[model samples]
Target: MLRTIRRAAFDQARTQLLSPLSLLAALAMPCVFAFVLHSFAPGRTTPDMAVGIAGIGMLNAVIVDLLGAMSKEKVWRTLYPALGSPGGLVPVVLGRLAGIAAQALVSLPGTLLVLVLAWGISPDFDWFRWLAGGLLLAIATTAVVGLLAYFLLRFPSSPGMTNGLTGILIALSALLVPNAALPAVVQPIAWLIPQSHVMAWTRGGDIPQILIALGQVVVFSAVVLASLRRLERIAREQSVPLEY
Candidate 1:
């Protein structure tokens, strides 16, 4: 299992890196957003803000790029063999997403560099905290994206749905705004979002909040594994292909 996962991760990372256009866009979008925010909301821009933006960029890679790759695999009929592989598709999916998540880490420094050079913003960046918290957030995001792949890959209109979902998640992520600033009713729903808790931790929240975020990651990971099992079972029993 470990070998399979490692091989898949290597392959996925290589493939993504080789795609220069996609790779450029993935790294550039966060910097663009950071510049725009710094230009307009100068007062709100801080080191924590840069970290939060970077975190959201990592998620954009996981959710958008990962799903886009899955869709391509389905179209090219490349996913069928993985589904039948000895280790099954779960590890392959997780590994590929892990690769993508790791690649997304580049956006961290990319965003910070833009802030420093473009805006003369010298943020007191905490490297240890950002790397550690960003990694945890990426893992949780990978699990959530893997689960989303199960449903989104089956539809013809997945691209539109993917964009819509990404926008919604970002709006509620609380990376740009405080949770307390959100409406009382929406606060509960935002708390349930893994990114919200993870962002809180990244921004120097207390220990309990980080624990809750890690707990959510574990739960989401378990749910993803179980869903993959069900997906495989249904595919075998009903002759249902991964895509419609």
Candidate 2:
């Protein structure tokens, strides 16, 4: 399994290396984020800002690297045949992982560099801890985004609508607004989003609290992956020859 995943990763990296749009999309988000966040909303550049920006950076990276490419694959009829190969699901999924990883790698550091050096903010680097927390956050968001990608791939009638809806979800799920400031009606809903906890942790919340949030993100990812299992099976079953 590890060898399969490793090969999938290498293949994906090679594909992305040639994808100019992937690199452009990855570059655009964080640069725009740093400018906008630091310029207009400097007051909001607290720990939460770090986390929120990082979260979006990570997500956008993942989407550009994985979901966006996956859409192209579906459109070009490359995905289903790949899935039909032996030990296929793992490779397909891992290939997605391999492809989009650059997004996370590039976006996170660039955003943080802007935050710490340019913006003069720091949330204690601690590489091991940061990676642990980041891995959890990244994986969780991937699950949600991947499930969304599946549905969109299955039904591309309105890809624009799908992307728009997802963008809206990412904005709200960001939890940028202070918990106290949230409307009473939406408070429960806001609290329920996995990204909410991720936002909290990003803001340099209490260590214990951050761990709890990590726990929630992990649990939520598991829930999302579990929920998608049946859908994946059914989608594959009902799917026909790949679209061109």
Candidate 3:
């Protein structure tokens, strides 16, 4: 299982890192957003903004890129072999998503550099808090992306679906704005997003919030694994073509 996962991760990471467009989207776009945001409000760029920008980059990397890859695999009819592998779809998908999640980490330094250079803002960088929160956020986001892939792969004709879902998640992530600033109705929904709690923990170093975020990751991961098993079973039982 570990070998299978490592191979899948390596393959996915190699493919993504080799793509100029993926690099631009995952690394360059965050810096651009940071520059634009700082330009708009000069001195008002907060550490939270840095986190938000990096979070957006991470989301784009994991959600957009992962879904796009899955869609391409579906079109090329290449995922069929992986589905029939001994480890099946869950470990392969999880490992591939892990590779994308790891790639998303580049956004952190990119965002930090832009904040320091463009806005003259030095955030009180807490490595422990950031790493803990980031790890949990990555896990939760990967699970969510995996879940989305299950649906999106079934309907590969909708090319914009990934972007649309990514946009909605970013809005609800509390990365751009404070949770308190969101409307009352939206506030509750924002808390449900893993990034909201992860951001809260990152900014304030709140233990309970991180714990809640961990719990959310656990739940979401379980759902993703279950969904993958069911998807595989359905494909086998109904003779559904996964590469359609």
Q: What C-alpha lDDT do the candidate models reach, one value each?
A: 0.71, 0.58, 0.73
Candidate 2 residue lDDT tens string, 51-104: 556667667666666656656666667666656666545455555665565446
What's the count of clashing pairs in each model shown?
A: 0, 2, 0
Clashing pairs in 3: none
lDDT of 2 at 159: 41
TM-score of each: 0.88, 0.74, 0.89
24-76 per-residue lDDT for model 3 (tens digits): 77667677767766666667445566677888788788876787667667766
Cα shift from native, residue 223, model 2 (Å): 4.8
| lDDT (10s digit) by residue, model 1, range 79-193 | 6787788777777777777777777777677766666666565456676667777667667667666778667544554336766665667657776677887889888988886
Model 1's TM-score against the true structure: 0.88
Q: In what order do the candidates fall by lDDT, top score first?
A: 3, 1, 2
In model 3, the Cα lDDT at residue 68 comes to 62
lDDT winner between candidates 1 and 2 = 1
